[model samples]
Structures are given as structure tokens and as C-alpha cells.
Target: MNRPVFMDFERRWAISGLEDLTGHAGEAVLPKRDFLARLDELSGRVEELGERFGVALGLDHSVFMGRAAILGLTRRGQTSCNGTCRLIESGDGWLAVNLARPEDVDLVPAWLCRKGDDPWKAIGKTARRCSTADLIERAAMLGMPVAAIPFSRHPGEGRDPDLSSQTRRLSRLDPGLRQDDGLEGGRRPVVVDLSSLWAGPLCGHLLTRIGCRVIKVESTTRPDGARFGPATFFEELHNGQEFVTVDFATPDRLRDLILSADVVIEGSRPRALRQLGIDRDEVMSQRPSMTWVSITAHGRDDARVGFGDDAAAAAGLLAWDRAGRPVFVGDAIADPIAGLTAAEGAMASLLEGGGHTIDVSLSGAAAWVADAPEIASW
Candidate 1:
């Protein structure tokens, strides 16, 4: 394995006085995959924000990068279904199946007509019986987060962005030399999180811990998938936040919520948001100091969907066993990677005075990590 393992922690990346504000309570030889500047990229945003805002952000790697946010629930004897989300063989090809929620587990018998207590047993039997397409259909029908493992290793290695990875496409909605909001201190910014599931909500959770006034906005029809996780874990993530349910069909209410926020965090596709008359770029233009964070499976522009494990594999982050079989590197790593990255990006944009839209796509983030040059190769 020629992948780079770690980088020396940088000192200039300190966040002043954040320890007291966000209790420092936590925290990997990450595989030798391309993730050379990943930590720096995550922390550099804070450094820039600190330099500009005159606030020393005391960001601890143990807390911010590690599973600190999830530790609270784990200590309470709750666990996430990271192992359940695995690569399984299908009639056509391999795909990732995640039954993190009880609802997803309950839907198994209905989807595959397999009756058993163990969800994995039913899932494995169903996957063996069904083709990849069939499994995908059933997953969507049940609103499950599943993705087909991408097998194509692009002919080109690292020239074009697509050569390294595809599906998740990130683009700055409106480009211009903008000014920051220049909020010096003592003003707690309002963050309206219009995202669900792992990555987007995780970003919101991080922001909330760091003293942002985060408001989680869900749809009356479709609620957050995290609600299916352990009760304690779900509460840990959403504990200190306000909640509001809006009818996306109405659109006006959701639009108003986002526009009024100092920061906007969303995890929907472009078409979905557009249908609700919520434009990220338009919002940024309207409020110069506003930061909009868009989190998605693929990029906001494309509809190629994925969850954590498959998206990481789709971006070429698979770990090979001694026999050379491809296995998941870690537990739903893409979700945490994207979540932490989005949080840092959001904070950087806010601290530097705003007027930016950061698009953090799971597949894209995984692809970038995969493309990081091997340490020895470098």
C-alpha cells in the first residue's frame, strides 16, 4: 500500500478559545490512500477564519476529526449500524446495503418477502436472489440509502477531475469577489439546517456544538433518517437545536427559513431545492454575509445517488484484504469526512465575512481523498 498515512499536525491551525466554548472531549492509521492534504484542507479553513476574524479557534484534532461527536452516544451504550452497511454480491454486480434504521430493517420482509429477525440475513438472501437493479428499486421504494459499488477504474488517473472520480459534481453557484460579513465577536449566528441523514446533519451538529444557533428544519412528509438511529444518538446529535417541520410543497415557508439564516445547510438535489424556490446563489447574493452549505451524495448537479460506503468505494477508497478482495475501509467514512469538511468550510465562509456557497458532495470528497498522491510516489 503506497498510500499516505498521516501528516504532522500544523500549529498555525489553532482556533482560539474554542475549548471552553465547545467542550474538548474526544478522540486512525487511515489507509495509504490519497488524503494528503485532507486534514490541512479541513483545518486551513479555520486558520483563515481565525486570521481574518481575530479569534483563535482552539480546534482539537481529537475532538473535531475523530468520532468525538458520536462518542457521547456510544458512551451511553448506543451504536450506529456502520457494519450493516456493507458490500454484498448481487445478481448483476456488487452494491452497498445500509440498514441503519429500524424502519429500513422492518421493510425487509415486505421488500424481499423474507421473514426473519436478523435484517442482514434477509438482506443477504434478498440480494443473492435479486439483481442490482432490483435491489436498487426496492431500496428506493422503501426510502433506504443504498448505492451500487462502482467498479470502473477510469482509464485516466488524475488529470481531469472526472478521471479521478465522477457522479458528485461541485460548483460555486455564483462567483464573484465578495466581502465577508466581518462580524467580530459576541454575535451568535443563526444556522438553519435543511438537511437530513448523516453528513449534512453531522455538519449541523458540529456547528451547534461550536456555539451556533442551529435550527433543524425537516419536511412534514419526509423526516430525518437519523430519527431511526438509537434514541440516545439521535438526541445527542439534535439535542441542543430547535426543530421545525415545513411542507416542501408549500415552498414559501422553507424558503423563508433559509433566507433568514446567517448560514444555510442543505442536503437536497438542485431540482428539489429549485422546486421549492430556494436558490443558494440567489440567497448568497441577497444576503452578502450568508454562507450556504450544500451536502449531497453526488454533486448537486448530477443525480447519481450514493450512501456512505458505496460512495467511498465509488470514489476508489476500497480496502483490499490479503486475498485482494475489496472491503470497506472503515465505517461509513464518507459521511464523517464530508460532514467534517462541510462544517469547516461553513465556518470558514462565515468567519471570513460570508458570501460563499460550499458544495460538499460525499462521492466528490471521497474521490479527492483517493486522488491524493501516495507519499512514496510524491
Candidate 2:
């Protein structure tokens, strides 16, 4: 009579002890209390990280919503319209939320994910562009969970500016002829620049007015700052401009895009480029006719990590600190200047018959002014 009592109890309490099934036999489900506790721990960790990294998580109870709510918003044509909520699901659950801002260029995309052991895990995302794989990977290596997404101007799924004109644009250019000086008819050359952040993308923007057909590529993985970053500069309008960065669906696709480019530029360090299978020599070898440009804070060997402004400041071009303490420059000047320099360099190399690798260092480029120290007598 008592033998049947244990079997009945076990069947009724199946969701009781999953985390601690040590020697209890068959698979056991973790108790709801334990699961919730684990989730809380993860959320707490995320908060800790937010504080440490100067990031604004701002996640609270109201910020936590169901998957249905997110999908509803997407269907109703509101991606970044969520009023502070995080979607969560256990086993086979997934959540999708639009990252696009109202006045912006619909840069952000929906994110999809299944709950993992950790709370704030990003399985995947969809956006017009993301930050950058290198940046994301570096952030991840430093303990951040970042995902990339892809967004297009195509008119589909209730999206505006639908249908990417990539093919159409490609069709307009001469197939075999190389682009010259980025200015043929005194109009900006159409450049499909798929590089993000500083360096490469900045080069494209500078060349945009110089007759370069620059189409800043973006995906869920890498978004331009003009739309997704802090409310500053061009992004301050909240128009969600998608040109703040470059993006790609896959590395292979990005490579193909690069192959089609007359001048390919990047800001990654030598080591980073090598990791991405894009060493200067390799790129020159692969194309043998294209101009490959790479920019960095320091030369190829220096381990200095930098952003355009920081690099420019470090190189003493933008100006010293805010207090004017004779400190290093404090704005992001390296990227623009370096990008401009690279474009001209590419143009020069092309004019001289291409097949050259240009490595522009923020420090070196900015030092051009310092080269004549006598002018500092003022």
C-alpha cells in the first residue's frame, strides 16, 4: 500500500527539483522558485555591468514584457516603441522587438532569442546595421552579450523605403572600369560603404561630396551612430539616420562587397585585420588592383586602442583637455581626418596605377602638423 504512495507523489511534483537532481534518478525539472531566483541573479549581474560600463540598462519590472507584446508592437509598426520592457521565455520561447526609433532611418531591427541559462542572453537580432563584429566581439570578450542584425530599405513587413536598390545601383556602374578620383561629373561617386564607426565609413562620407557614390551599409550587427547611438550630432534629430555605420549579412558577403569596391578602408589594427582574414598584403594580393587602406590609433605594431576622437586627441590634433591643461585632444578627430587622408591616398595610388596598401595611423597622420614644431612658437 505504501509503495504506491511514493510513485504518486513523484508524478505530482515533477516541477519541483530540476537544479538538484544529483542522485534522484530520471530527469527532474528545476523548481519555479529556483528558476526565478536564477533569473533575478542574472538581472542583478546585468545591472552591475551597466554601472561599471557606464551603460544604461534601465531594465525594471515594467520593462519586462511577454513575447506577444513585442510581436504586437512589430505588427502595429512600432519597433522601438516599447515602454521599457524585456521579453523572456523558457524552453522553446522567443521574443522579438524592434530597435528602430520613430524619427530615425529604421536602423534597429527585431531581436529573437530563446531563454538560456543566463537571463540577458541575445541569440540573434535584426537591424539595418549593428555596431561591428570586431567591436561586438571585443565587448563580448570583455563579458558582454551582443548580437547583430540586418535591415534593408526594402518595402516589406510593414517597413518603409522597402526594396534595396543594391542591384539597381550596381547595374549603373561600368562593370570592368575602375572608379576615378571619386569625382567624374562633379557629383558624388556612389560608394556602397559597408564599414562601420570611424575610419572606413568616415572615408566614405568625406568622399560622398567628392563624387563618391557612398551607400553606407548597415545590418543588425552594426548600426551607424547617427541613429542608434546617444542623442548627439546628426542622431540628435532622432530621424534614425542609417548612414552612421556600415553593415553586412555575413563576412563572406562583406568580402564580396569589398571586392567590388575600388578602394576598401578600415580602422582595425593589424592584428584585428589578420584575424578577420584581411591583412593589407592579403587584400592587395586578392584584388591586385584595388586600393586597400587601413587606419589605426598607432602604427601597425602599437597596442593602443582608440576611437577617432581619442586617437586624434592622443596625436595632439584636436586640442588638449576641456580645461586646456595642455593635455591631449578630447574629440574624435582621428576618424574624419584619417578617413579623408585615406581617400586622397587611395585616389593618388589609383592615379599612380593602383595596387597599393595604405596604412594611416592616427598618430602619424595627426603628426603632420607637429612635424613643423617651430610654428608652435606662438
Candidate 3:
């Protein structure tokens, strides 16, 4: 079997495509970091797993550029390519705020303790008066996707030597089971996808492409937010997967569906599912061979609210423009990256006979790529 290699030409091609898709008013704005390199590293892991499983994987730069193409999105400098997130200057520092939902827009008055015809203007004015910490704290408490910019360097500055060792992108939450303890060899695994939106669903989609049976489960009250997004984009991610809806108030059906799966993917804060009567520790204890992929904004232990744009900003993944201002790199760049990372982690766990909780966070995943030494020169 042949292994996939992300060649230099392919990386350049990917970058060119991304630049074309995300350019502002026909002018290309390259990101400060080599995002293609990050995608290459992540795709390589998935390809290696494909090779190990005797399956052919032909992923390329298209994975990162797909949603943008489907949604016809473009870069907006300080605003995200998707136009829902923005980089606001707080009193002490920079903050990223995403008002992707209508409810988020409605909460702007409460968030700033003042009302305005334009939510962004109100947020900007209020943010300038408040500290980054205060804004982020209040936003998190209100279930808003807000984050503080962690770090930024000038164009010619050298990479921080200590940063790479400071944070980990992927974490193992449980001890590994024996190699022979899980599903018997040559049997297809069933994945119960209890995640919505981009990251978790993308993970399940990739697993489905790799021969797993993925069943997407959404709550009757709260379906995947992506459903309200571009129809083409949503279809692109979930074209052939099976979808099931259940009432959370009555979670017996949901619990049964989760317990029957060999792998489970969820993109909720830790307590969301517990309130729904789905305890991860208990589920893992019952099915010791199962792989649980947990996707969060921060980590499983942290309660901070984050979305792709804000979390990526929190991870210091912003691009620096010519005027030395920080700008968003791509359209919710962390979402696809986190999704790919989660898929890789889930595959690795399954290959090792399951029984692991793979924790992959948006900020951490973006940081993992941002901390790359080679990105400093880009």
C-alpha cells in the first residue's frame, strides 16, 4: 500500500486556492502563518491511519477550502472570512467576538449594558471601555462565543522557544485498553455522532468515509446549527450519513443509541450531556472498548465558551496584516482543523482497541499548529 505525501507543490496549490477563496475585494491577503503546513500535518496523520487500515485516503487542501467555496465566503481583514466574527480592541487587549446566531445579536444590549441599532458598533464601543478579561468572562457566562487574544508578535520577530512546550493539543483522558480488548479485527465500527456544527460532524464524516457506519443524532429541540447555514455546505459535510432525532427530555433512546456504538463523537461542554442523562464516565465504564471523542472550545475540564473564530483567536492564530494589525486567517479555521484532529485521534484510539476519551479542543488544536517553528517565517 502506498502512503500519502503532502508535497510542496500541493501545499502551494492549496494556499493559492485558499487565498483566492478568502481574498478581500479581489486582493489576496495571505495569513501570517503557513496554514497549509498545518493542514498537511493533520491530513498526513489521517492518511497514515488509512494506510494502516489498508484503505486508500486521498485527502488534500480541498478539505480546508470546501466550506468557503460552498458558502462563497471571503476574508474581511479584522472580521472573520465568514463575517460573523470580529476582532475588537478592548481596553487592555484584543478580543474576538462571534455573533453568529440571532440570539447573540439580541444579547448585545445585555452584554454591553447599553443598546444600539448596530450590535457590532455597540460591542466595539463597549469593548473599548472594558478590559479583555471582563468582556470574555461576561461573554462566556452568557454562552457567547468570545475570547481574548492570547499572544501576538511582530512580522520579523523570532518564534517563542518556550511556547511549544506550554500547551498540548490532544490529551488522553483515560488509560488505554489492551490491543485485543476491543472490537474484533475486520469488523466495521459503528459511530454514534451526538455532535453538531462543524467540528464533531466533520470528524464523523471523515470516519464515515473511512468505512465506519456514522449515525448523526440531533436533539428534537436543538438541531445542528449548521442546518441554518448554507444548504450546500451542510450537504457537503453530511451527504450520506444517517441522521436521527430524539427528545432530550426522554433520553433513554439517546442513551441506548450511544451505548450501542463502538465510537461516540460529541461537541458539547462537559455538563451538557450529563444533564441529558448521558454520563461519559459511566458509558465508558460499561463499554470499556468504546472510543469517546470529546470536542470542546477549551478542554473537558474548562467551562469557557468558544467557537471556531474566537477559539482560534484565543490560540493566537490570527494573521498580521501589513499595518501590523491582527486579522482572522480563514473562515472559522479552527473548526476544520479540530475536526480533522478529532478524527485522527478517534482512529488512533480505535486502532489501539478503543477504551479512551480523546479530548481535542478548538483553541488547543489551533495552538498546536500555530506553535510550529516553521510558521514563524511565514
Candidate 4:
């Protein structure tokens, strides 16, 4: 079989998608790294589940880069920005911004303190006026999703290189069963997706492909902003799932909604969940067999907020352009990587049948991708 030509991003596809995500070794064009070869090994265990239970739980590595090529399969002449999400200049360094939401368009004017009919032009003009630090600080304060790409070939966030991309542990136990929740192979697990945008939703998407009954629960006040992105792409990720809207004001109903799931997928910070009257500890303690998958830009242990591309860059998953500038590896790469990684862990926990939690950090996954040697130059 001929391998897909990833062009500029062939290297990351080689590492994160190929070598790391799938333990396939062969004659390839891109460089390789052991940046936790075991990270994607969780996918192998899923194969075991399929064989043991007689289900078709196969994983396609190509799907991991859906942002780059999935939309190309359509007739549209590419939606919005050109490929690679527009790497622009900041006063000090370059920062990555994904206007994944309609509200984010309004943030550009507020960020620059200037008004313009064109969002990109206004963002470009405003970026020239301030340093990367200033823009990041201002974006953080305004709740705007933006990140600065670092030139040093590391994530803008300084996390230890040795940090594992995911944490899967037996955090709690089901009082009901000290046993494998035997699957009939025809059973569909329930997944409650409380995440928006890419990462967590992608995890839910992957789960649905494997016969999981996924329910995408969004807040009525603040729905998934990704609904404003390219229609085909959004639909591709959210297809084959039931969608529901809930009011965060009612904690009892929210708790019941999540508690009903066999697995829970979420991306908010801890306090944000608490504010909505949802606590992982309480939920897991109550139902130890529920697998809670928490996707954070940082980690569940920390409350830092981040978007996919910026957090990946901060975690150091970027290559330098010929001009020696840090370039975003691909479209919000950490989102998909963390999504795939988290899905693997979530599936394992579900079959194991325990109240276990998987902490899938976007920065950690990005760092795993960035830890590889720069791919071959074009």
C-alpha cells in the first residue's frame, strides 16, 4: 500500500500518527522517535477487546489528521484560512490563533482595541502593535483562545520533556464488581461528551465509530463554539451521535446526565466543572465502574487554560520555517493527538470495568510530538 504524502507535515504524521500512534515499523520517508512508543500501545489493547468480544474496533491512523485532509475530500475550495491555520507575527514572536467560535471574531477587535470590518486584517494589525507576551496576557484575560508559538523549538509552556502524555490509573473501584465487565461484543457503551471544539469531541467521535452510543451534551448558554466552523468538518466529527442541550443552572439534572454514561468525556478545568456542580471525584466515587476521560490543555492537576495549537506550541510541538521561525505543526494538532490518546485509555478503562480516570493533557501530547527530531526539510 502506498503511504499518504503529508508534504510539510509528513514528519509529525510519521511520529505522532505512525510510529507513536501505530507501532508499525517499515521503510518510511520521515524521521522516527521513541517519544513514548508505548503511548499508542493502548490502541493494541483495543484490538484485543475486539478479538475477545467479536467487535470491529479497528483504528485508522489516517483519521487522526482529519483536520488536514478530511475536508479536502469535499468539493469546497477550502474553508476560511489557508492550510496550517495562518502563522502570523507578534511583536516579539509569533502566536497561533484559531477563531473556532463566532464570539472569537468579536474578540479580535477587543484585543486590538481597534475596530475593523475584516477580522484577519484587524488581528494582523493588532498583532504588530503588541508583543507576544502582551497579546497572550490580554487574550487570557478576555477568555480569547490564542497562543504564542515559541522560537526555541519547545512548547511556549515549559513542561518537563519526560512527562508522560497520558495518565491511566485505577483511581477508584466499583463496589459492585471486582471483575472484568464482560462484553457481549454487541453492546454499545454510552459516552457523555461534555467537550466542545476538537479534542474531547474527537474522542467521542472515535468511540462512536467503535459502536459507542455517544450523547453530545452542550450548555444552552454556551454551546459548542465549533458549530460555527466549517460545516462539513464539524458534521464529520459529530456525525452518528445524539445531541442535547442543557442548562447549567440545574446541577441535579447535569449530574444525572453525566452519571448515566458508561464513559465521560470533558475538557473544562476542574473549577469550571465544580461551578456547574459536577465533580469527577464525587461521580467516580459513586460509580467506580464509570470511566471518566478528562481532556485538558494542561492537566487535570493544574487549572491552566489553553487552546489546541497554542498549547501544543507551548508544549513544544513545532518545526522552524526556513527563516528560523516556529511553525504550527498542523491544524490544532494536540487536539487530535490527545483525542486519540484519550480514546484509547477510555476504551481500556471501560472494558476493565473500574472507576478509573485518564488525564489526557494537550500540552503533554504536543510535547510528545515536538520531542521528535525535526522532520526532513522539503
How do all models score by TM-score?
0.66, 0.43, 0.87, 0.71
Please provide, for model 4 over 1-378, each residue's C-alpha lDDT reduced to its tens digit, 9 standing for 90 to 100.
123333535554454543222211122222333332333453554455444434666655554556656544211111111222345676666667767557787777887788899988887887877877778778777876676654523345332323343332323323233244435543677899999889899889877876789999998898898887678778988999999888888867778989899899999988899998899999988887888898887678655467776676666565443445444444566777788777767766666663678877887766655665433333
**What pairs collide in candidate 4?**
154-316, 155-314, 155-315, 155-316, 156-314, 157-314, 288-355
Pitting candidate 3 against candidate 4, the one with the higher TM-score is 3
Q: How are the candidates ranked when ordered by TM-score, highest leading?
A: 3, 4, 1, 2
lDDT winner: 3
**Candidate 1 TM-score versus the reference:** 0.66
Each prediction's Cα lDDT score? 0.63, 0.38, 0.78, 0.65
Overall local distance difference test of candidate 4: 0.65
Better of 1 and 2 by TM-score: 1
Candidate 3 residue 149 Cα shift, in angstroms, is 0.9
RMSD of each: 7.7, 24.7, 5.1, 7.1
Distance from true position, residue 31, model 4, in Å? 8.6
